[model samples]
Target: MTEMRYTTLGRTGLDVSRLCLGCMNFGSEQPWMMNDRDASVDLVHEALDAGINFLDTANVYSTGESEEIVGEAVASANRDDLVLATKVYGDMREAPNGGGLSRKHIIDQCEASLDRLGVDYVDLYQLHRWDENTPIEETLAALSYLVESGRVRYIGASTMSAYRLTKALYTSDVEDCSRFVCIQPEYSAVARHEEENMLHVAEGEGLGVIPWSPLAGGFLTGKYEREADPADGTRGAASESVRSYFTDENWAVLDAIRTVADEEDATPAQVALAWLLHQETVTAPIIGPKTSEQLDDDLGALDVSLTEEQVLRIAAPKQPRYPES
Candidate 1:
């Protein structure tokens, strides 16, 4: 197997795989999840065998079963060779202090995640979402403690407004805390909203940009038809949330992507991921495949290069929108 390429995650000296394996679908607790423990373990092994050293998971995925599966999957591998990551700020329990970016929750969840993953430290401990109730300083302070304590090497934020991300970064600087080295956002041909300011902010701030849902929750795979209903077992058919992505404008975007995919003699999924890989600001786009075949197809994106005209054509009409000052 050809080894996947590696890249530096933002300004950090750590090198991570260009294709990060996301373990969201690794466990069966969630109704939409398709992988069981053994299958999840096999996928992780295959990913590592393919030279994908970066792995992303969250505490809330399958209520921590995902982490357990990941833990067993990578237990025998040399820990020092991988860049392990997991997120906090999700409700892991029903208690009042169950979630959010509060100091207590951040610290508590970090330990719990460490326990679940059976690892001493995570390379990147991300704030899954912005916590409005918690002060930025408080969250940063707690995360700083984790870094100082050697429980987390680096920190990242996901899915926050550009303004909010700016504030958090500024507060980390002023407070003399460990700043976020990366940002994970939803970015794809159909979800170009992050390009408006988030991508620019990441570029200017020297933050690594790792995008999730690079295929727009499987919508860019050209599986869902414009007139017909989503097929059974697909993400679009299983969840109303995924169905929301099948908008008229997104269908047009998919049409354009399909045209380009045909011209390039590649699958729409590969072309969609290649679009993200071609981005100068993107460090990597996380690929969460339900099966080994899917993982192989996603990795094929590395070979699908697009011309400048093709890139522009794929992104035409839907310009990034910026907020007014």
Candidate 2:
């Protein structure tokens, strides 16, 4: 390998590989666009062989298909050389008690995640999103219980509002529970929403920031035309979280990114990923691939470096899509 890099997850006592394999693609068959178990297996092995120690998936991913594949892969490796993480909090069932930070839900899902992954414990278990109805204490308490029970090695949170994340960290310290060791936010060259505040808060609190969709919902993948075809494929549909950013204005950023990609003789995907790696607070970028070729293109990011001038050239000026415009 190219002397693959590594970094420590702030205060989590977990040293994670700089490049984390995202298994969200392994989740659903209806989302027939993503990688299936067999295809994902090949890509995961490619990452493992490349010295990637961090693998991120979520219970809600493909309704837990992602976790199943990641779990199976980890077990097959049997080296304990990788740090595995997955999330909970999206509705996994039709019942009222199906999801959220409810003590019952968190605990129930953690065990189910473990079962699906075929592992006794998860390296890091995260709340996929915040639940306003439930007190942060209740959520942290349940997460603490898991760590204390040895079912989870560490805990993190994803998609929490800035205020809620800060509140959770403080609550964990005051209540003597497992705090969020990390925060998963949507960030990338085109998605700079987290930079507004979450990035600073995470860096200050000693919590690692793992950015999901660092590729900007396949916009950074070098495909899709802003004018020619507007309907995003299934991959873009999964990014309902960022549906608002898919606008004509954001296309300007894509155009500039493409220019830089051409200048470097690299794929836009490689340039996009390289953009995120330039940030120090970015512990790792969650990258999902549906094919070995796509996975290889993502890995090529490790080799491409952008100059300071180049980084500034495409830096999103304001909101990707103006709030008013």
The number of the candidate with the highest lDDT is 1
Model 2 spans with C-alpha error above 4 angstroms:
230-244, 319-325
Q: Candidate 1, overall lDDT?
A: 0.90
Clashing pairs in 1: none
Give one digit per residue, the lDDT tens place, for model 2 in 1-325: 3557888887766888877888877755555345556767777887888788888988887788877787767777864787889888889999998988899999999889989988888888988888988988888999999999999998988885678788888898899998888888888887787776677788888888888988876777766765444354555555564456666667777777899999999899989888888987888888877777877788788888899988887785546331233
Error of 1 at 44 (Å): 0.5
TM-score of each: 0.97, 0.91
Tens-digit lDDT string for candidate 1 (267-325): 99999999889899999999989888999999999888899998988888466675411
Top candidate when judged by TM-score against the true structure: 1
* Model 2 residue 19 CA deviation in Å: 1.3
> CA RMSD for every model?
1.7, 2.5
